[model samples]
Target: MLNRCIATDAGSFATQYWGRQPLLSPSGSLPRDFSDLLSGPMVDELIAERGVRAPFIRMASHGDLLARDCYLGPAGFGAEMPDQVDSAKVLAQFAAGATIVLQGLHRLWPPLIDFVREMVADIGHPAQANAYITPPTSRGFDPHYDVHDVFVLQVQGEKRWLVHEPVHQDPLTTQPWTDHRAAITERVREDAAIDRVLAPGDSLYLPRGWIHSAEALDNTSIHLTIGVAPLTVLDVVHAVVDTLATVGEFRTSLPMGIDPTDRGSMAAIATKVMAEVTDTVQHRATDISEGSATRLSQRHAQRTRPVAVRPLESLAAAEHAGFHPVEWRRGLVAHVDHHADRVVLRLPDRTITFPALCSPALDALHHGLVADATSLPGLDQDDAAVLIRRLLREAVVIPAKQPEHPTRTSRG
Candidate 1:
């Protein structure tokens, strides 16, 4: 899908420009259908038919946000008035030259969710999406910088953008335009690092802290800004501090008499803290070890949107079909470990422990090498079918139409 949106290979875009420099892959260079991610009709459906609410959808003109009441009204139905958007009013506002911002469409829109989910898995980081629908010749924001990296894809019409080099390089998520507005405003007046009019299919990548501004051209403009949140050293520091809480000496109280306000006293306190941190820093990798890996994988698993599980239907199918063929669900991993007495399958939702005798069958499934329940070792065909049905009930696996690759199975 990235390649569908991008003009070049996904690997090249990632290796050459990601987090390092701005990339402008112009129109024709991109796939012809790149703009299909979102369009005017879909936006209409989301606003008019779906009954979208505030914060999720907002309107702005020259950087000032319009009052919610201007575009949203009382729901004629059961939902709160404040939570319902007045589609008519919003369209009127748009006609009057306001830029409509559709926030977090990756979560709200199905296609975007699938696309962003793939990117998150590919990049090993968090990614979010937002869309901007600006009237012809209108601007929505100030000449400011974002705290996260952005990939701006022009879906419709055109937007002329002026981008300046960062005033502060690689700013953290905590450091936003508000932190240094005066400096940022002064910098945008200076020459920009990149400036161009982005028509449909044009894509631009802006690293965090790159000052920029955009205005719709002769026609209504729609663009998607995919934000990639940077994981800073501060996150690792926080993780280490969490680790230091287990150390008794580090947890002990600071100097009793020193004033926290005094520079000399603060210096002494800082020095002691630094010494302890230095001692802890050497083992930071160990502190974050396999536990960190497990936590990350678990988060990815949890990030997967829930799917409908009709276990009763699956059970009925298995009974009629003889044996069920199971496949691993998308964005899921089953970390299987065996002990003397049990087999542990640590899943995204929960852990399952089965008797050690079932290890061969479980191991085969873990490696995606088993699909047919009848092929599992250590279990009679009937028992194997029963186990497979139970796993379907738990949503540990989905029914597969065909069998998987072969792997060594244990003799029972």
Candidate 2:
């Protein structure tokens, strides 16, 4: 997926461009255009027929985001749900030069959902998709930077993009472009680092904190922004700090009457505390590292979701689990831990336990083996069937017939 979005191979992107600089792949550089992921008609379907509501659908004109009421109203009659997109209102706004933004398309649209899931795995980061549709000769956003990295894929028509170097490089989620608005506004006044017109099949990659903005050309333009949020070293430090809660020394109360408001006294205390923490962390490095890795994995799992599962189909499959093959849920983050008498399957949301006898089956599934009851190890056929059935119902495994790759269809 990453290779498809860039003209260069994945290795070149990682070493030279990832989180460092911007790369613009000229039109026709990539293998194919992004119409397979999204298109102009798909945008209309979302607004007019998908029952899209606020947030999922929004509009921006010139440089400001319009109010929700401008394009959304009740669904009318049976639905009667306020905040659903009113197609008439959307058309009026679009005709008036407002850019329609389809947010979280990775969740709303099937193609994008599968595309983003694969892209996330390829990039080792959490990713999201949003479509920007702008009228001719208009800009939707002001010159600003995003805290997360983005890949802009031109789907239709053309748009001119101007990108300047970052005023603050590698900004965290808590650090937004607004915090450096003054610097960003000043930076854009100089010659841009990149000034190019992106047509269908073109792609651009921008690291976080790079100031950029785009304007539609003579025709309406549609594009997808795949935002990737990478985990930083600070995340690891935080997990290690959290582990301090298990140490009594770190949990003890601060010096009494510490004059909390006094800068001088607080500085002294901070110095002493820092030294103790640094020493403790170094001495117990191995344990802290192991714990921190688990914490980080849990954090990542919580942020991402497994591939979509079909409840009805899964239930039906569970009823006949002994015959067909099953594989671990694609993209599910799970860790299997064995104990004396039980095996624990830790998921992002919760943990599931099973008798120790089921350890072999769970281990095999966790390692990505597709199997039926007869193929499962360490368990009788009947017991393996029961285990498979339970896992199917729990959404831990899905039938092998389901494809994990994105289909060519734009709509699911």
Candidate 3:
């Protein structure tokens, strides 16, 4: 929830906790139900069913061959599992992977998915939210920092984090640089100033560029890392470059033949091109913001059709209590309100506006939690069908429960 923290003016947590100067808002607070979102048995099932995979380092054991390292060992159930079994297993898995990069929420265990959805909705950037879990006694990644800002939540067990001040002030640049592995390693060895253990319910905020590493404590640990994607000057530059590609001057090559003595003419042409590029870049931020909002508003499941049975008319009337519909995709959340005759969905890209009339139908089709058209009071069969078709076309309604009959529908 990048904007949530920004909106609440709590974006300065990095400065408050890590002694860095404040740059963004510092008003928002972590959700109180953060722990309840991840600690449970459903998580345990994911751990037990998963397998381990890691990179191999060369060893001199038998004729310069690579040996299999047992970082977290084979993924298996613990005999004396912690009370919060699922969270522990997820954390253990994360540690085992060393540097797990999660994308879509569909890859996450069901319980975690639910928790993430709620949190993203509350934070006001539901469409731009995602979570990553790590395993115990393992380090999935080498000591490194991220390009995006992150909020780390310790749901179960404990994890030890070693933090180092950022050496590169502007880390998230479009122009690539050589990996800073050697420098980071040297810095960590020199002075380990920020080292702390993150226990259950504990939270850490790491801005983009600050280097850090994590390892599980004695017990297995499960933690959720909520990453926020920020807009930057580089992003604007990229958009401007992309837009400039359509211009005739950008498409045409420079006049190289008539150059040497006509340097003044060529310079004037170059200046004109530069002016256009600069103007585009200057206005690119607004375009990026709108694009972001559009992405947020339109994000939803990719279901082709609704699966759950629509509620009966009597039951629909009895259970018509207004419930906010929340969706989580790619670590972002979208909150849907059925009142005010409008539906507002937010994401990292932008906020989308839709008619409130479509909220119930959209939620029913996307989440698969509420009943379908049959139960909805105002929606008729045709109306539900149209809405479902529209959402599917927009890539918002994803498949929910599989159809019982294999031949019932055509696959996308």
Candidate 4:
């Protein structure tokens, strides 16, 4: 997605100012045009014909957001509370100089979906995409900073953008720009770090808390802003805190009838608690297999959506409507737990257990290599097929390319 969004190499950007300073890419170096992902007609079709709903699309003008009820109303009688987008009303507002904001396009639009997935795969961070369509000579929002880092890609026309230095550096999600609205407005007027006219194909990277606002110039303008909410140390701390719940001292209630006004009692309790905390942290540092930080990372990986899956039509074409020629999916790992009688494979979506005898075959497949149903070494064709089929059903594996007759690659 940074194909056109950055002029310099991504490695250099990460090294110098990934989350520290502003960077601008002049564009036109892209192998292919980026505007093909969205256009005027596409926006029209989404609002007028696609029946998009609230929270997905919002309209703003002169810093005030139009309420959802203003453009959406009830439809289909007989106890059905379904709401439909009022296209005519929205179009009228747009013509009247309102800016249209398409929210969560990473989940709703196909092109952005692919882009976001690739970004997550590459950067290991959750990302979302939104597009802003502003009318000529109009500003959509008042000057403000975002709580997340954003990659601004100008797709159509031109937008005059004023980017100011951050009032609060690296603001958290809980820290809204509104918290320092006065400070931000004051700073935006004093001096700007970057004030440029972003034309089609141009792109800019702004770290969180950098105040910004834009106005369409000469003609209608559209831009895609890809927001990245990078995982922070606070997140890892939270995960660890969650695991601390298992500790006895952490779970214990405060001293019975402890006076809220008594500092003596509080200090006594705190000292005891500190010892427990210190000891627990020391142990956690020594062995982190069951620690919160490791668990949090594992949980994150388990919750990630599969980047690819067999097509519906392909499934229907396979024998018995089952996916064939499968392999382990990327961004996934099968966690194993051994029991006396069976071994369990924990997947992102589900868990499965098989007789302990199959552990060797399971380990073979878990070597981070692609394989077909016939690849299991010890099992006969029928047993291997059954095992592979069950694994596919649980989404533990995916269809693989030919030559894996089973294919293979060294575990990285």
Best by TM-score: 2
Cα lDDT tens digits, model 4, 1-412, are: 5545677787887888678998988765464356777888888888877767777888999999988776676555653444566788787888999998999888677888778777766667777889999999999999999988898988889999999998899999999999998898789878788989998888899988889999999899999998888787788878777778766668877767789788998888789887877788887764433667457667677545555666562353234312256656655645777788998987655688898867777777777556554567667767777777766666666666555355575432
Candidate 1, 1-412: lDDT as tens digits: 5655556687898898777788887876335544567999999999988878877888999899999888988888677666678998998999999999999888788888877777666666677899999999999999988888888989999999999988888888777888998898889888888889998888888888888999999999999998877666666556556656667777788768768789987998799789867866666657554555565556555545433345776666556433556655544556888899998888876898888888887766655654566677777777677667667766775666454543433111
Q: Which residue runs does candidate 3 get wrong by more than 4 Å?
A: 1-35, 39-43, 49-106, 117-140, 173-178, 258-272, 279-412
Would you estimate the TM-scores of all the predictions? Answer: 0.85, 0.95, 0.52, 0.86
Q: Global CA lDDT of candidate 3, please?
A: 0.48
Per-prediction tally of clashes: 0, 0, 46, 1
After superposing candidate 1 on the true structure, give the runs of residues whose Cα lies further than 4 Å from its correct spot: 29-31, 79-81, 280-288, 292-324, 333-335, 347-350, 358-372, 375-387, 399-412
Highest-lDDT candidate: 2
- For each candidate, the alpha-carbon lDDT, in order, equals 0.77, 0.89, 0.48, 0.77
Model 2 Cα lDDT, one tens digit per residue, 120-232: 88998899999999999999999999999999999999999999999998999899988998998899999999999999999999999999999999999999999998899
Model 4 residue runs over 4 Å out of place are 2-4, 28-32, 74-82, 261-272, 286-289, 298-304, 308-323, 329-334, 338-341, 356-368, 376-378, 400-412
Clashing pairs in 1: none
